[model samples]
Target: TVPGIGPVYTAGIVAEIGDISRFKNHNALAKFAGLTWRQHQSSKFSAEDIPLTRSGNYYLRYYLIEAA
Candidate 1:
């Protein structure tokens, strides 16, 4: 198990992410957990303080954040 995460959180995360094979990699898993930063770019400008996309499985995100 993870250092800070307990059994319940681990189970919740696993349950929310039914099939691990569906994701291509860790990045894909992060995206599914809504833990990725949003893109903020234009013609020649890119914002430095972009927020999270906040899209995807809500329960997974909640479990991950709480565990952290």
Candidate 2:
């Protein structure tokens, strides 16, 4: 078994994402779970990116955060 992942957390993540290989990379995985932050920009200057996107699976996000 992987370190730091107990049964419940592992089960929850697996249940949410059936096939991990479907994601091309970590960014894809994060996007699927809605854990990526939004890119903010104005006319001439790009704003500081600080907020997470509202979209994504809340359950998966919660589990991922908990695992971290």
Candidate 3:
């Protein structure tokens, strides 16, 4: 069992992320879960801090965050 992830959260995450083989890697899975940081680089100016994209499976993201 995961630290904070209960059965419901695990089920939700599994349901939302059906067929895990579809994703190429963990990065792809993270992107699908909307847990990736946004790109804040432009030419010579790069931002040190960036926010999450928040663009993907809402339920999955919610469960993951709540579990965390």
Candidate ranking under lDDT, highest first, comes to: 3, 1, 2
How much lDDT does candidate 1 score? Answer: 0.93
Task: Name the runs in model 1 displaced over 4 angstroms.
Answer: none
Candidate 2 per-residue C-alpha lDDT over 1-68 given as tens digits, one digit per residue, 9 for 90 to 100: 87788999999999998889999999998998998888877788787847888588888988888888
lDDT tens digits, residue span 1-68, model 1: 57989889989999999989999999999998999998889999999998889898999999999988
The clash count for each model shown is: 0, 0, 0
Candidate 2 vs 3: which has more TM-score? 3
Please identify model 2 stretches exceeding 4 Å from their true place.
1-3
The CA lDDT of each predicted structure is 0.93, 0.87, 0.93
Q: Which of candidates 1 and 3 is the stronger one according to TM-score?
A: 3
* Model 1 steric clash pairs: none
lDDT of 3 by residue, 1-68 (tens): 89998888889989999999999999999999999999888899989888999899999999999998
